[model samples]
Target: MDSQSRVFAAILTESGREYTGNENPQRLKVQAVDRQILNNRVQEVQVTGTAEDCCPADRVSVRVSVGHSKDSVNEVTNSVSRRLEYILQVVRQHGASEKDTSVRRFLHREADKYHMDAEVLITFSDFEKMERVRSVLLEKLAKSVCVGTPQFYHSAECLSLMRRRACVSAVENAQQKACEVSQLLGQTLGHPFLVREEETREWKNEDEEDGGRCQNATRLPHPSQIPTITVSSQVSVSFTFRDISKKKPQ
Candidate 1:
């Protein structure tokens, strides 16, 4: 293959949410403040992937969130840090026994004066183990921290995997497409002498809001009313055309 051997590539993205129980007392409170927190957590868990496997580089981002009073930033920060530390300890205890399990990245944010968010990224050899890690974190967070449940999202990885797989499929599809185009133009398709791929990333806020009579909202009977969260990813892809030649009259 020459340096200019052209081939076509494309990207595909996908998203999924890891579900768990929400047992926070504040989540079930009839007050609007508590209701907002519940809604936020539910929306966070409901995120869905745009493509199936691969994600674009630029679209790789995560959102972390927590609910607290305006003056509680310091307290919230310390609480979140301790919670994460405990999570890391859990990974060290259980994950160390296995391979390809470690912390990839961790982030913290204050969406406003009243809310604190922590985004934690953990990597494992496979999805099954990743699920286990999520479960472990949820348990630890519930017991160790007074904050809402901690959620995990494979935002970029979801899209990245989709893109990688799509690229492979796109090559096959592009080859067939090129062949059809060549035949239609009364020409023969030459071997791909050049191939290139282009991609872009976009950020979007997936927000969910409910407007209804507060008095009518159903109330959870228990404090352990498992919180719901949604995680999602977005991206775009383009494939370029390449190499053309004419066939002799036959």
Candidate 2:
């Protein structure tokens, strides 16, 4: 359906008083000369707009663990430590940075048998390399190795940047719509009185198809196939509904 722009009386107030109208009055905020004048003024316009941005999901967190069983606690711990070190070295050779790998070892005693488990958290941008690492570790460690599922996510810096861009886009949309309507009515657009966010959302799209290469036995989803991170924002903006052309010189 086609949309229509409207003109409303500009009322700037912060009395926290409840107002009754078809729209939410709390969102109608603006700098005013006087609250009494704002309430009495009859020129105002309301505009609501929405915008979104999609960023590629390049970062992924992969958790890998190895469990070893031996007759003595020392033997299990030593074996697990050696295997963990080797696994880390393999990952590093495949482009995983040392700063992104965190290792933790757990030892437990069950009767005469001792069990030791070593786990590592690896964060990187390459999904294929991660899968290769997982496969090679499983090949060497056999039954003692376990490759946990990789959880996909984006970096903080990327998401923050997208959100800010989306906000600007939403405001621009509102401004364009407002300006068009005001011109048609012979009124010049003024400074925005209020811009309040009505909705902010973040989500990942997982419906993209990558030509039968989405996932494999390593439990790593194809980065290109998975949905990218998306940010959306909706805002209700209020602008002064008046004319700059008819102003008198001071």
Candidate 3:
């Protein structure tokens, strides 16, 4: 091989290293540049930061029941069926779809008297729409109707969005902390070089449901304060800093 072709070439190692050999060796080998490059990429200040917030539940479920009594099972059942149909129509008018509603029927007979009931489970994405539907059901069904308190919870999409927002806040917190630390160390803050999410946590009010206790309810459930969802995030960020004092004199 030509001596000129033996020119030094760069190589990588687990840890950056420097090689200083003969002034002009016949075969020149280049090394240690990677360590310098890696050092340039590595950040100087490391910080662990966290952020948390609570988001109100936006999804709701309302269960309604209609019941009737008559001399025959079929008669009472037909009566409840008519009321349920009316309730469904009212729900559709308020923007609910068939896919969002579930219907179930019940029957009992005793000494020529028949009792029948039908319940509808309606899922609503908007509270205003639910309020409208509830009003119509109460006005139309009157004595035979009962409306339950809306069950509040978070949807998958809502949870995902909240989690992302929490992570972003956590990163911001880490940067802020790093900036303060760099200032205390007499350094100028630079852009973050690396970020590692150490943990993500979720918390809920002990008095409220956390998407685990779900039940098919009937009759009116007394209203209480709405539940809340909280998501928190922890992140470790490596922030770059510059030594302002090290700048070359003018």
Candidate 4:
């Protein structure tokens, strides 16, 4: 057997996007950008799980964005606060399960003379039932906050939890493929001589402002879904091949 070996590397990826909107140009632009990023980075795979049509059954977390003139921060805050309260009242009226609904994060910033942004995150267990809540909020903002639709995202913690399983599966798949290739090379595969697994997360535009100066504001599709975590594995495998000269005499 000689100490020479040939290795090959392969990768697999998966992704998803969830959103709902009319034919608004702005919305379409956002959707297109989101699709482009995902298509370029992700591979098609059968992901089991209903597209998160509504928030999860457990408490769903939501982010609300509000903006106003810098000089009007106080006014904007007051108005937005009142509007939120009204929204809460409406949710209560609609039988929202308040036990799971609460404020999660808040941010306020001054961008310019005519730009002040405030953001609030609300968490609730029953997101599917929030249609009334959204309607009430829109109605409240009609006369006050000059903001667009409040974007919703599955919490980071939730995503990490969900992806962990997928990551494991991807790792196993990579190993199997590596072994298959080793077998096809006419050699007995040995322990991995070297293995490298890498994952890269890219967003459309993480530097965009979100109601305020968001460090990385990615305008993902309605589901605020990220392209599947691309788990790439590079393995340098060593295998033993019998030397023809050393073959046993029949």
Local distance difference test scores for all models: 0.37, 0.72, 0.70, 0.41
Model 2 / residue 243 / CA error / Å: 3.9
Every model's TM-score: 0.31, 0.70, 0.67, 0.39
lDDT of 1 by residue, 1-250 (tens): 0011222222111222222333332343232234333334322111111322322222111112223334466766676666567666765665443333333333345455544544444444343444455455545554333221222234455555655664444455555555654455344455554444433233323322321112211222132322222222232222233223234679
Arrange candidates, best TM-score first.
2, 3, 4, 1
For model 2, the superposed segments whose C-alpha errors exceed 4 Å read 1-42, 205-216, 222-229, 245-250
Judged by lDDT against the true structure, how good is candidate 2?
Answer: 0.72
Off by over 4 Å in 4: 1-86, 93-121, 124-128, 139-148, 162-166, 188-199, 204-250
Per residue, candidate 2 scores C-alpha lDDT tens digits across 1-250 of 1222233433334664423355675676644455455345556578887888888776777677778889988888888888888888889889998888999888888888999877888887787887788788777766666666666667888899989988878888888888887877456777887989878899877743332221225665554765588888888889886544345978
How high a TM-score does candidate 4 get?
Answer: 0.39
Off by over 4 Å in 1: 1-93, 96-144, 155-160, 201-250
Point out the higher-scoring one by lDDT: 1 or 2: 2
- Candidate 3 C-alpha lDDT tens digits along 1-250: 0000011212233344322333344444435453346445433777777787678777888888778889987788788888888988898888998988999998988677998877899999887788778777766666678787677778889889988988888888777767777777456788777888778888665454433232233333333356677888887777666634345878
Residue 47 miss distance in model 2 (angstroms)? 1.3
Candidate number with greatest TM-score: 2
Clashing pairs in 3: 16-35
Q: Which residue pairs collide, candidate 2?
A: 8-43, 8-44, 8-45, 9-42, 9-43, 9-44, 10-43, 10-44, 205-227
